[model samples]
Target chain A: MLILLWLKNKLAFIPYFRFMQVLLSHSKLKELISSLAKQLVEKHGSLNEVALVGIQQGGVAIADELVVAIRKQDPEAKFEYGQLDITFYRDDIRKNILTPDRMNLPFAVEDKTVILIDDVLFTGRTIKAALDVLLDYGRPGKVELCVLVDRKEHRQFPIQADFVGQAFETDRKDKIKLVNDEKGNKQVVLITG
Target chain B: MQLSTRHLLGIKDLTQEDISLILSTAEQFKEVLQRPVKKVPSLRDVTIVNLFYENSTRTRFSFELAEKRLSADTINFAASTSSAAKGETLLDTVRNILSMKVDMVVMRHSASGAPHFLSQHVPAAIINAGDGINEHPTQALLDAFSIKESTGGLEGKKIAIIGDIMHSRVAQSNVYLLNKMGAKVTVCGPPTLIPKYAAEAWGVEVNYNLKETLEWCDVANVLRIQLERQNQPLFSSLREYRISYGINRQLLDSLQKEIVIMHPGPINRGVELDSDVADSKQAIILQQVENGVAVRMAVLYLLSGRN
Candidate 1:
């Protein structure tokens, strides 16, 4: 395995099979995620057509870990993972970087249970933008939100996470960041105090 | 008490206190801009990137001046001139900048909500310079500031914004801000350009002709005709466009002469406006240009965690 070690800034996984491989080695999040996966499927009951859609960049790896853990119990379950870039749908359209990278909606998401996962949840607007886009394509039987960390702030939209690995109460001034560890495990950290 | 980086994406989310803060801060910066010094050390170590996907001279240069005055190192990045043509995406570019830990990003893109897109993915604070016909918050803010400066703060005044209502982001933004400042705004343009029920949506009166609009308005803001937007030729001809919709010198004669004339320009002389009217002292075209820098500086300073 050619270890592509970029301290940060690898987007879309365009050139390879594994993008966030650099993040898996640090924390024991993989083991913990394994235990949570068993509890989640057992509690929710069934994963036949359920799909995992990650909030791009940091959230994709965690979604992968969750999917792997789910497949362990029910191998026959259909699993589809996708990435969402909600820049265009945002209300604050002026502050975005003038030129975006390549804008791509590379998957067809129609009528599957979308388990939207993000590494850290803050204002919930990103989730809302993603949800708005998801609805534009097709209506799922049930659309659920899952996040590795829930930094509870006043949400502008009426949305909540279905599965939260951890929760933190923070003011508007604080920011929560999540990254993969050196041991191939994901870890969440607080950036601003 | 929060003094860290705060995003200034849209004015819709700002409180009256916030708007006052930005304008007052901008007012101070306006003095700094005029001084022989023409610079300040407030944002000395900061890195400001100008990401303009759309083509604009006035708005882009105003933001450029704002960054320069604050002593911030600025980089000009346009997609047409960058590796984007060779296939580099927008987020990939931001991630690269993120690695550099650049302080803030000011962006103007042709695609609506592009700024909002960057705010979500990137960690840095973002300012929307202008987005595709959605909103130009700073322009509206500065226009409001200029109006307030002239009429003792736009209270109980009739402001008319005339021409190209369908395409003018300036009209959409100013209508809202002026109303917020207690000014009765009248939007005048052709039936095709102005929406059929715009007055209902914007909570401002809409008129089809400029003559009637000018008689009632205290301030008349003229809008430029977008030549590039001529897909099927929006109007019959340039001569016809100027005659019917433009605030020409001939048309200006019949209106209340006290009404201040304004335009967010690259003024097509004799097209959307008469050459004499553009040069007229009543025209705040140049004032808007000059105030644009101060207004943007105020916006940047307001969001930059700098007082």
Candidate 2:
């Protein structure tokens, strides 16, 4: 299995397979997440007034990892955590059927510093929708975004993430996938036909 | 599921996915209804005209509240006060309203397919609030939404729509929407009230026995009898119909399993359903009304996208 993965990675370096390159290994992702948590703690001084909201599906796992890393740095930190599902807030709702994820925001978001977390930043439309949905909850004192991978192409909205793990440029046909193993191991891969 | 059609004329024009999309969108609007602000800026720039030609209290109020909650400017046009009462045709009245640069029209007319006719001629989006005995799309959408909220989903659920099936646009719309959502619909009423072609046309089970039908269902959606619409008595008497099919607390207590009860009001308390049963814990009648605003909000939001 190790030899097969190594061969796949080596083949991904070829120009033809460049679209299917694995950007970050599981350990590298963990290191970046830890660094992000440390940066957040230092920037905010404390997480008492901070609220970490995960955009559904892709952002959920990354949000959970960041929570654990933040806790490790400050065990007594009391950061509010919630999940936001922006399915209904999307502009393309009339064009297609979107199965909504569970929206479970248990606490109030009023007057809190909200940190929106997602897996990848692509066209920035999802972030726009998330911002619309979050306002319905309450007005936040400030809003910041954290993303795992930033695709520097085809952005239709004028929005950017405050903290990004890695940045890459890809063509329109290239697809970015964040894969997670059964043991919670994470990897980012770019796929193209 | 995207709503490909420009106007929501009936449930028959919608796909299963379209129904699902509407329900999910309504769920989000439901959340907004629970917020302290209870308003959104999604439709701030849009203008809606509630051109209700028929008399309505609940549906009109619900749609008006939904439009206001979405921050859309709305104009209420009743036929009693407008040119519709001056012998103006629906086309002319709607065209005049459209000329005012209306973004959408929520219409309730006395003639069937009135909205459909206006939809073809007018450029604005048309939402059928209720058109005679044809369809009330929003009512059915809210009924389906309430059922989904209670049971988590609509797939494989058994729903029995009782009373005034022939004169009810609600029954027709519910039958189509529920069946599309994979629910088994058994429409029950008196022999004279249940039209023969309903079963043959809609392919739904038609049963005259209410007790047996209720026993085999998960939800009982009781519709109000349109006494004003009936030119002649369809049944022998109101008392006779009530004795035969009226759902009371005694009948409900005898059921082996508890089932959710529903009624589209203004309910004839002693006629279709007893006040006790209507006020019972299993009844989701109030939820249906509350969901109406959210469902209408979703429909307006989606339709405004086309403009």
Candidate 3:
């Protein structure tokens, strides 16, 4: 696993799995989450002006893990947490009917540094929709992106994640998903034909 | 999830899953209404036409506002102003509108099955706002949404729909929707105002006594006595109806348990529901109107996704 982590971006040409391969196991996922939390606290000093918003469905799980990690580091952390569902703001709404998930942003987003967290960054369309949704709420002081795993070089929109747990150069058709394992643990997996 | 039917012609046409989908989507739209900017761009590319052959205040405004909230381009057509008043047929009016690329039609007519008639002739989606005494699907959806919001879920809940049951498209639609959602419904009014077939056909309890119905139910959806629709007097007078069926404060206080109150707009003040009960904390009459936009938006959004 350590060797696989060291050979991060070099796995672009590796024969992709037919079934699935666990990219980030339990312990490795914990390490990446802690690192992401540390980076957030280091960048945004007191965590007072920052608001962590998770994209609904997958991103919410990663956001929960990050919140726990951040709280563990600083027990007095007073950052705001929110969950957003961007199904209504999507550009492909005319294609098919999509069911919306929960969206609860009790706190104000005006003039706050909003950090959007997602499980995997792929075509960047979800981020675009998230940005549209956030702007409707209020003007933010600053907007940044964070993802547990970044699938590089496949962005359809001009969006990038500021804090990334892992970056992989993979095929356009390849799928990277953050899912829960049997023991109720967060794991990132790569799926291919 | 998508609606099973292409047109929201009536609640009888919807499956349990379809009702659940619309209510859940309405819940999301309700949240959108609470935000500072209460609009979404889901239906920005769609064009809708509201065709009203009959006069309406709440339904028309609610649908127009719902369309605006979804960012859909809307053109309002009243039978009094347009070619409809010049003796133009419903089919021709709709066809002429569709020729200009209208994607959907929200219609209300004095004739029952008028929207259904247009659905067979037109290419666009049809949403029946109200059709004579047939059904008002959006009103029922909003009532269901309000009931769910107030009392939680609809399953196994007792709901009494009181007042002019025979002439109410709202009452018919409510019966269909609430029944599908597992709510035990009792239609209460004077026997003259309730259809004889309501019990056997709709599978709802018919009670002429308002007090007994109120005591048995968890929610009282008091409907207005539609004087405009009534050709002849169903009862002796408004004062007599108020004495027997009116839901005053004393009648509500007599019940052992508190019941959620709901009305589908334009209350008669002292006819079906009294002023004190209408203004009380138990009444969700205002919420019903507020939920109307959200529920209609959900319907339009779901139907526009269909081919």
> How well is each residue in B137-251 modelled by candidate 2, as lDDT tens digits?
9999999999998887898999999999999999999999988888999999998888889888998999999899989999999987898889988988879889999999999
lDDT at B159, model 3: 96
Instruction: Itemize residue pairs with steric clashes in candidate 3.
Output: none
Q: Model 3: residues >4 Å from true position, as ranges?
A: A1-18
Candidate 1 structure quality by residue, lDDT tens digits, A30-144: 6656766776687566765666787666667677778888888778766666766453345454343111112223344556677887877777888887786566545777888
The lDDT ranking, best first, is 3, 2, 1
True contacts kept of each: 0.00, 0.17, 0.69
lDDT value for model 2:
0.88
Q: What TM-score quantifies how close candidate 3 is to the native fold?
A: 0.94
Per-candidate TM-score, chain A: 0.73, 0.86, 0.89
Interface root mean square deviation for model 1, in Å? 17.5
Model 2 iRMSD vs. native: 4.0
Q: For candidate 1, write residues B4-92 as lDDT tens digits.
A: 23776666656666676666666666755654457655566678888887887888889998999877888888878888778988899
Ten-residue stretch with the least lDDT total in model 1 chain B: B1-10
DockQ of each: 0.01, 0.22, 0.64
Q: In model 2, which runs have C-alpha deviations exceeding 4 angstroms?
A: A1-27, A42-46, A56-61, A71-77, A85-102, A119-135, A139-145, A149-193
Give the worst 10-residue stretch by lDDT in candidate 3 chain B: B84-93
Candidate 1 overall Cα lDDT vs. reference? 0.72
